[model samples]
Target: MQPFMNSPENYHILESLDSLVQSISENQKEFFQKVSEIRDNHYTLVKSYYEESRRLIEMLKETAFLCSLMFNIQDEKSICASAINILRKLLENPVAIRILSTSNSHTKLEILAEESSAAFSIKSLCTKSPLSCIAIKTCRPIIHSPLESAVPCPEMMESPEQYAHICFPLIADGVAFGCINILFEHDTDIMLLKRNIDLINILAGYVSLAIHNNRLIKTVKKEALTDKLTGLPNRRFGMEALQNEINRSKRYGHVFSIAMVDIDHFKLVNDNHGHTEGDKVLTLMADLARKCLRNVDLVARFGGEEFLIILPETDIDKACVVVERFCRIFNEASLSDVLNAKNLTLSGGIAQFPHDGGDVLSLLKAADERLYLAKNSGRNRIVAGKLN
Candidate 1:
């Protein structure tokens, strides 16, 4: 203070410079450490999330494909198997799967898909916080958790073991008709879960759409080829189906029989009672024909008051017996008596595959010849084969 008083400004400047350098060095070290922490966190989060999203997408796609198989058959086995495979793939970390349907008054939970399925595990599947209905679903991008398991499914006490779950719902017409859930052995992050959910929803929506489309296609196809009154393949569908079956029999070296059925004096019933009575008779005849055949047989409304039967693996004799029994059952069911419409009777013409003729047109022509003979000979009886 005494000596530097003459040049105090210079001394002060030197001291301030030293202090500034120290402060900068300390800040740099702290910043570098922070950068390292952020880098590590980003790596884990990005990599895991990416892998999980990819896996979920793949599983969902596979599930969609599997569900598509339902269009092929009326049985439950194939459809259920396809659903299981989808859940097993999507929820590898989960203990099981539980499907819930919301199309009715009560929420019906169906175990459509599962892997290592628990005898009882409710905690992993549902909770009040994110009720099955409240759960989010998407046909678009998902950036958040779609379902919550925080409240724990109220049905948990009815189950066994610890479980967590994610849900995929099938929505149509603004209604959530069905849901698919993944049961996990542990809890998960809300954010990551939201992403997983998005993937699942995309899958669910696609599958639901496909199923709906296929169902509609089936209904339309049935209607197009079927006679609504008789529940038989309509003329349009009958021809194509017969042609296809004819080819199948020849290619496979299997015997088949074709029969054309007509109501004997059907026009008289229409004229006497009304068309209503005639329609009833037609329906009854189809029902009787259906009851007489094996699972592989096909029946079609060949035309007005006319029906045809395709019997795979059957010869002319067997076809004749089948038709005869069908007629007997018709008499037993007694539709005309029950409805009080008209007492009905029928005449039929039968032909064996290959033996009767080589093709659909040829076989049909031969059967028509027999039918003509039967009608002229006197009605109410069967005309089978070449009549030889």
Candidate 2:
């Protein structure tokens, strides 16, 4: 035996083992390359998603400012439109459809606005949708999967694919004003919505405050222009309206008339029956004037026991007829008993654009001069037309 270790058989066996080890090393190198490529692709996807998220957050901030602008201008329609536009932008990914829901006084959730592609039809949610009810009642965010639960409405089931639904309640000061619903198509990253929950909540806050402030502004404006006692436009508003009508007449060449009406023996009634009864009489007169005038006419309280009426598209002749009818109606009404007097009557003076005088001041002066004449001529009568 010449050195068994140097035998050809043994050498061949050693060569085979070395070849097997080399093949295993090559396979391991190829596997690592595949893993490295997969990791690079994942990182690229993550970077793209992050950039998109940052863009959406910037948009949300801009939307908040837009809501502020709409509130400042008191444009309710623009507010809704702006909200829809911002929502469409923010929900580009994951979201296939969006719906804005507002609670009506009738205790029903009304779809105020919506934005969606043509492939999808916007449908009303079920009245008994538990998820929506819960979100509203809790004033918090609710998320659910329509495929796993029955929370989805019939419209949501149209796709029959896995989808995520989110509802964010528009709440401020513990009051739920409304909710925003977002529907996500299949394979959407639920994490995206989760990450933006805080931003969405902030947007909801902005919307709620805008709507509340707008309503408050409207109420204040209405109160400022209205007479507290008689519920008619006050003298300030009347003056402004007169100026507007003057401009309109000048621009359009349309005729309009003004009547300055005074209550006869009004001071005596106030002195005898007290200011409370006087207030009642004023309110009664306002109601009578509003009821007797045409829908196009504007009646306003000029001052104490005085009313200014604007008759658009009417010449002096038609204005006189309207005023005469009002006089007859007031004289025949049962207001005499309310005033505790023998007769309650009105004295009116009429002035027409271009006919009596041009411009607001001229027309007002001419009407006032005639009103003076009516008071001097008789306690109950009308003074109209030019004086020679």
TM-score of each: 0.71, 0.76
TM-score of 1: 0.71
Prediction 2 TM-score vs. true: 0.76
Query: What lDDT tens digits, residue by residue, belong to model 1 across residues 219-276?
Result: 8888887788887778878778788988887789988888887778888888887899
Question: RMSD, model 1, all Cα superposed?
Answer: 6.3
Those runs of model 2 whose alpha carbons end farther than 4 Å from true positions after fitting are 1-53, 61-73, 93-134, 150-166, 172-174, 181-196, 336-342
Candidate whose TM-score is highest: 2
lDDT (10s digit) by residue, model 2, range 21-126: 9998998999899899999999999998898777776767786776566666567556656766766666655444343445545356666566665666547443
Q: How many collisions between residues are there in candidate 2?
A: 0
Question: lDDT, candidate 1, residue 44?
Answer: 91
Position 131, candidate 2: lDDT = 43
Find the 10 residues in a row with the least total lDDT in model 1. Answer: 137-146
| Model 1 accuracy (lDDT, Cα) | 0.66
